[model samples]
Target: MRILGIDPGYAIVGFGALDYTRNTFTTLQYGAITTKAHTTFEDRLSEIYDDMTQLLAAVKPDAMAIETLFYTTNQKTVIAVAEARGVLLLCARQAGVPVFEYTPLQVKQSVSGYGKATKKQVQEMTRTLLKLPAVPKPDDTADALAMAICHAYSYRSKQYGVALTKRQQMGYF
Candidate 1:
């Protein structure tokens, strides 16, 4: 299975593409789509949409896994992120890619074997799982890769009818 994981944000949207086969992962690509801090919000959205459209075309992932929004104290930031996420979803829909949503807890649990694992812990586990030489930079990039790894585990568990974890046992369907 080819999976693309997305860590959505208006400022820096992180993306990672991976191919999962026989319980192993092959990293295809990982990077961030960054919008300038001073750009107009509308312009930022446009940039995100355009870049994501091109990315979807290039990756052609069988599934797009995205982090679902979590509440934050800053309404402004939350709203902006949500809008960016909307653009991402639309891009996937137009490309005919199947979309899956996962929360931070699910990602952490799947990657690090702990639901409340620290960000550094998850990053390290993701790096280990993918057998990368180093942790991906720009924290969000690592987070995106973790998301991909999480989806890969979930996908395999479903395919093999094995509940590897509590999340898999409950079923993400």
Candidate 2:
């Protein structure tokens, strides 16, 4: 299966594409879609939508995994991220890609075997899983890769009854 993972943000939307099969992963691409600060908000959204549309067409993923929005102290930032996330979801649906959402905690647990794993731990694991010599740059890119790993594991857990850690086995579904 080819999975595309997205870390949606108005300033920089991170993405990672991976192909999973028989418990192995092949990293296809990992990068970020950056919008200039000087651009109007509407133009920023347009840039995101256009870039995402082209990316979907190029990658042709079988599924898409995205991080759910987490509440933040800054309402403005939260709302903007939510809007970007909405566009991502819409694009996925329109492109006919199956979309799955996971929280940060779920992603950490799915990839690192602990719900509270540190960001560094998750990034390291993501790098190791992809057999990359180094963690992908621009933290958001690494986060996107971790998201993909989370989805891959989640799918495997369901399809093969693969065992998660005791903590994860409790309420993962």
Candidate 3:
């Protein structure tokens, strides 16, 4: 299965693509779609939509995994991220890809076997799982890769009829 993972943001939308087969992963690509600060918000969103459309066309992934929105305190920031995520999801839906959402805790648990794993731990585990010499640059890029790994692991378990808990089924650790 080919899976595309996205970490959506207006300024920087990170993406990672992977092919999973026979219990192995092949990293296809990993990068970020960056928008300039000088650009208008509408223009930035358009750019993101266009880039995501092209990425979907290029990767042709069977499934897409995205990080679910989690807000700490800033309502304005949360709303912006939510808008970005909406565009990302629209692109995936238009491309006929099944989208699965995962939380930060779920991603950490899937990648590091610990729900409370630190960001560094998740990044290191993602690098190790992909057999990379070093962690991917730009923390968002690594986070995207971790999202892909989480989906791959969860999908594999589901295919084997492993009865994951409701929280796990809902992509929460």
- The TM-score that candidate 1 achieves is 0.92
TM-score each candidate: 0.92, 0.91, 0.92
lDDT of 3 by residue, 34-134 (tens): 99999998999999999999999999999999999998799998998899999999999999999999999999999999999999999999999999989
| Candidate 1: regions farther than 4 A off | 159-173
Better of 1 and 2 by lDDT: 1
RMSD of each: 4.1, 4.4, 4.9
How many backbone clashes does every candidate have? 0, 0, 0
Deviation from native of the Cα of residue 137 in model 1, angstroms? 1.1
Q: 2 or 3: which has the higher lDDT?
A: 3
In order, candidate lDDTs are: 0.92, 0.91, 0.92
Better of 2 and 3 by TM-score: 3
TM-score of 2: 0.91
Least well predicted 10-residue stretch by lDDT in candidate 3:
164-173
What is residue 110's positional error in candidate 2, in angstroms?
A: 1.0
- lDDT for 97 in candidate 1 is 98
